[model samples]
Target: MTGLSPVFPEAVLWDMDGTLLDTEPIWDEAMDALAARHGVPMTPQLRRATLGNNSVDALTKVYDAARLPESGRDFDADEAWMVAMVVKLFARELPWRPGAVALLDLVAAAEIPMVLVTNTMREVADIAIETIGAHRFVATVCGDEVAVGKPAPDIYLRAAEIVGAAPGDCLAIEDSPTGAAAAHAAGVPNLVVPSQIPVAAASKRVFRQTLAGLTVDDLARLFAQARTDTPA
Candidate 1:
């Protein structure tokens, strides 16, 4: 841990899947299994294309790739199957992405408020939180809880409001381009820790190899720097 700085982000928002938990692989596997059960194949290309979408959106992409039905009973059945598969995996082990626990612990210790801002629905997110420890967050902003999901900024905006922070004052920890885009669009400073996907840096984004070994000093330092660089 590094020395605490006088400056602190009003709140820190986190993306739950690949950012905090290594569940993207489980998502990939479940999507593949769903395809296999329906006599369709989930190729690597297809999986990569829909890496960060919610269950329903992912189903749309997968079904399209399979040339299968995308709505009504077909979509619902496939979505249910995928969720069940991943939920079982999550129950067995909600694997933490590298350095996630340490960062969470340190930030919490510093008395910085934290919240889960994720595109994953509340039900599925709740399942993972059991192992992750629900007390880590003051609140969780799920995809279903917002009007729109990531890449749109509704969830992050809502999370900031819930935490009593201004969107511009909050720092978002993200793991993918989709999430980075969402955070940036919301006018929040985001620290991207690449997980299953490598997040590319853009005007409103910053990237780190991993959250491993990062200290509150690191966060404060980065937040301080971004606050200066951020546009009004």
Candidate 2:
């Protein structure tokens, strides 16, 4: 038994953007504006590549796509601009993902600690947190606070450390391939609820069409199944 639940996972690590909230379209708008500012359009391919990317990485990709001179690029300035634009869009209305609120309530009722683990910077993520209610999380770990973002284990590892749980003992809820890959690299089993793009099947990963009507027991089952599916 872990915490108040008779399950292997002691805590839940949640992704913010597409997992808990429908903020991807907001990001699309901001990234499109950014691409236009750089004298290029936001192609479907570029948008897909930037999904789940941190500010720095996404900005770099945008610059590359624009064919901008590397010597003339200002990473810090561009990152600030992007975050500002996203924050402006986020301010309008932050919508929750389907069943996200209900599932959060169920998990809280079970007395399991939850942490917000996102590749978004604190400035931008705080707005979404407000919509989701900061009271629901025990901690919030962001990309700017870590040495590296998703697709690397640093963010997930840091989140686990904050909650004092081993990676394998934590269940991650992710919606993007980048986030799932990070959790997998950290040895954490994740329940993948794809929001925009399809995530390929892999060890320590389980899929769900949506979070609608998911129960606490389902979480336990998913965690156990991922552990079982993983190689010893």
Model 1, position 184, has a per-residue lDDT of: 85
> For all candidates, what are the clash counts?
0, 0
Q: TM-score, each model? A: 0.89, 0.95
Query: Using lDDT as the measure, which candidate wins?
Result: 2
Candidate 1 lDDT over 1-232, as tens digits, reads 3564458898999998899999888887777787787667887777766777766667777667667653433766766676677777777777889999999999999999999988887768899888788899999888878887877888889999998889989999998777888898898988888776666656556667889999997897778776666433
Error of 2 at 200 (Å): 1.3
lDDT of each: 0.81, 0.91
Give the alpha carbon lDDT tens digit for every residue of 97-183 in model 2: 999999999999999999999999999999889999999999999999999999899999998998998999999999998899999
Off by over 4 Å in 1: 1-6, 69-73, 228-232
The residue ranges of model 2 lying beyond 4 angstroms of the native Cα positions read 1-8, 230-232
